[model samples]
Target: MSVTEYRQASAFGKRREPHTVIIARGDDIRHFTIRPWLAAFVGSVLAAMAIGYLLATSYLVLRDDLLGATAARQARMQQAYEDRISMLRAQVDRITSRQILDQQLVESKVSELLARQSQLTQRHGRIGPILDRVKGEAGGLPESAPLPASKPELRAANQPVIYADSSAASFWSKRPAPSGPETAADRADRLFVAINQSLRAIESEQMDGIGTLTENAFKTADEIASALEAAGLPVDIDTDDEAVGGPLLPIDAGMIFEARVRELDEALEKLETLKAIAKEMPIHNPAPGKPVTSSFGVRRDPIIKRPAMHAGIDFRAPTGTEIKSAGAGKVIKAGWNGGYGRMVEIDHGNGLTTRYAHMSRIRVSQGDTVDTGDVVGEAGSTGRSTGPHLHYEVRRNGTAIDPLRFLKAGKAIGKLL
Candidate 1:
């Protein structure tokens, strides 16, 4: 039906009729009548009341369960959040501890490197001048020239140019400490990386310096060896022959750097020892500006008037002429012998000795330490001589070799000195 017809029918029906309900139970009967709209309204009210009662009852019965479930879910969420927080805290603690340890290691390395560099600087200060003197004596390159550039220098020179980054110390020092929790971890990470890079650069420089120093040490050692060989004395070189055996322990960069420094120190010590030994040996002119009167070996003895092996050379000098020691040594004999009157015998180390015979006066006593060029006595014809002359002999293990060899060697070495 159309909407207007339906509405008209509903209006007529509401105006015309009232409905009645009757109930009969056993001996009683009841009847009631009402308008249709009022009955419908009363039925609706009854249905609404019944539904409200049911909803109220259900809410009373199930309210505790619903609230308990909600509380349990909230507690689980809280526990989960707590567990997550604990895990994150643990991770943060571990990361913080690791970073602290790394920082400590880097600081220690930096301290060690600083100490090593200081030592190297001191050594360079002390040894550089001595090396220059040695090179001057050896006729090596001029002192102003760069000391024979090494492989490290060559490599550095050949390397391509690189942009420099900010210095770690400055960068870290300038940065303010993070105030917020969110950025603290990131800041720590950056700090560790920067520190690591700085340490690497410092270690690299140290290694390169060690390489150059080692090369120079070897070169110096070679020169010393050659000098000692020319003197016919065996060189005592350090041969690090001790065996190292273990479970193959691992070594870090710092240990290697320290070992190189130690090696350089040993080499320098050896060089010093060699220099001291060379100074004490007999290697200087004994009687300067004196004419040779007699040569060594077989000659006619002036007193005996027969051919005899002359063990010493004779230098003609006027009476009271100064007789100097050839090298620094302890005097062993200074009194008169049967043929050698007022003689002086010097005990140079290593079984080498030099004797000056026929002196007019002995200036040094036995057991007195005399240095090279120190006046030991006066030249005179005191014993077994036809004229005032100094008889000089070089003895090795109580047997006399030609003294001319040592004189010639001294003359050659004196030019260098």
Candidate 2:
């Protein structure tokens, strides 16, 4: 058993006093007095120990909860990081796919452009020769004026927005890289557009050439017809009575190039026929460097000294001077006829004839072919003439026509040829 009692402080000091303790074990009693300072010290030590024990208990109970919360926060952060990575990967894949598609489309367009260029080159090779021939026949100008040798190119458009990418190096190399404000795809598009423009230029030039040829050919034909009409000859090129027949099959109007080529060919053919006819017509002067002694129509006769209709022009040629045929023809009468002595009548085609009279000697016999400027006979005053002269007469369908008209037309025709 133990008993402890605390004595009050003294009235004078108002401070803590001593504490007495009694302990009895088996009737043995002992007493001990603790001083005021020692009692206060003991109480303070006990209070500090109680507070320390409570703080340790609180820390031990909350440690697991704190650790769990930190782990959860770390897990959320890792998941967020993974989601971000997945999004970035998808974006990269989409970009890559788009780039690939663009590259493929560009390649396809390039191939088509190349193929078209080859075809245009081949067309130029054929059209160049045709254009040369047309220019030669047109005498420098066709229709209105000369056409441009090469067609102009198409103009460019507004610039496109360029994007950034790592895979831009695999494209065209001729255009040095670090290209400003334009991507590889845009550059390729520009190249293809230029190529198409070049092809269109080629097509335009070809069409222009065809049109020029057609115009010139028609003009030539018209001029030739006019010449033949003025010279009292027929433009014997038959167009309406040609034997042409075919089934009315479907025609392709889209084939503009081929259509133009065909049109040019037809015009050239018509012009050629007119040219042939003009070539055969009598448009040449029979006597070179010989002055006209007598004009045709209502002239005083040189021998009779009376007014009479002169059917031909008389060229003052010396005796035995060479006389050439007026034009291409076949001789029908090479011997004498009536007062026109030593007459040689040539039957020119298309209901026409020429009379070369007053000749001393005939070189071409009947049924013999004679070309223009061919020496037909030697000149002498054998016909009804007073002096040594060559009488040249042109007759259309057995009717005497003026020879001056044919000679004048020949001068105009020489310019075109």
TM-scores for all candidates? 0.48, 0.69
Stretches of candidate 2 off by over 4 Å are 1-73, 125-129, 140-180, 238-253, 287-293, 316-325, 333-344, 358-366, 372-389
lDDT of 2 at 287: 84
TM-score of 1: 0.48
Candidate 2 versus the native: TM-score? 0.69
For TM-score, the strongest prediction is 2
In each prediction, how many residue pairs overlap at the backbone (N, C-alpha, C within less than 3 A)?
0, 0
Put down candidate 1 lDDT per residue, 1-417, tens digits, no spaces: 578867887877753445778999988999898877888899999999999999999999999999999999999999999999999999999999988987887677667656655654554554455445434433422233234212211113234322224565567568786676646447445544544454444445545655665555556556655665676655666666688666877887656756766775665566556555556677666789998878889998888789999998899899999999988899999899978877999999888999999999999998899888899999998877888999999898999888887777566545333
lDDT of 1 at 158: 30
User: What lDDT score goes with residue 165 in model 2?
Assistant: 26
lDDT of 2 at 250: 67
Candidate 2 positional error at 322, Å: 6.5
User: Model 2: which ten-residue window has the lowest total lDDT?
Assistant: 160-169
CA shift at 69, candidate 1, in angstroms? 49
